[model samples]
Target: MSLDLTLCPDCGAPAEVEWRAVMESTDGPVEHARVRCLRGHWYLLPVASLAGPGCRLAQSPTSFRE
Candidate 1:
């Protein structure tokens, strides 16, 4: 299965790759996300699914927004 991470908002690099693994937010499960690039750079993204269109990171830091 292909990872659904977003592009880096700073470097335009696509995060969430295979083998490297994905992580969720620890800030309490936000609708958005923060992922790492191939170069190991981290960035913000929308919470997408690993199963389908609307999923989330398996186990990473999450932030809940109000």
Candidate 2:
């Protein structure tokens, strides 16, 4: 999986793109990426929406606590 760098929508920190794939959804094939921030915040973002203007993480993020 190729890694891409993006800003964490929640923390505004650097995030790492874990992987991307096209999934079968009700609408159609939607591309998504799993990203993790330096603060261990995880988010699943739609690839297309990332390019749109004023894209922000309005949804709550997922965090795995150890």
Strongest candidate by lDDT = 2
| TM-scores for every candidate against the unseen true structure | 0.38, 0.66
Model 2 misses residue 13 by how many Å?
Answer: 0.5
Lowest summed lDDT across 10 adjacent residues in model 1 is found at 57-66
Tens-digit lDDT string for candidate 1 (1-66): 545454444565445632332455675554555567667886444445222333333232131111
TM match of model 2 to true structure: 0.66
lDDT of 2 by residue, 1-66 (tens): 434666676877757778898999999899998888889998898876452334332221222221
Highest TM-score scorer: 2
For every candidate structure, what is the RMSD over all alpha carbons to the true structure, in angstroms?
11.8, 8.7
Each model's number of backbone clashes? 11, 0
Model 2 RMSD vs true structure? 8.7
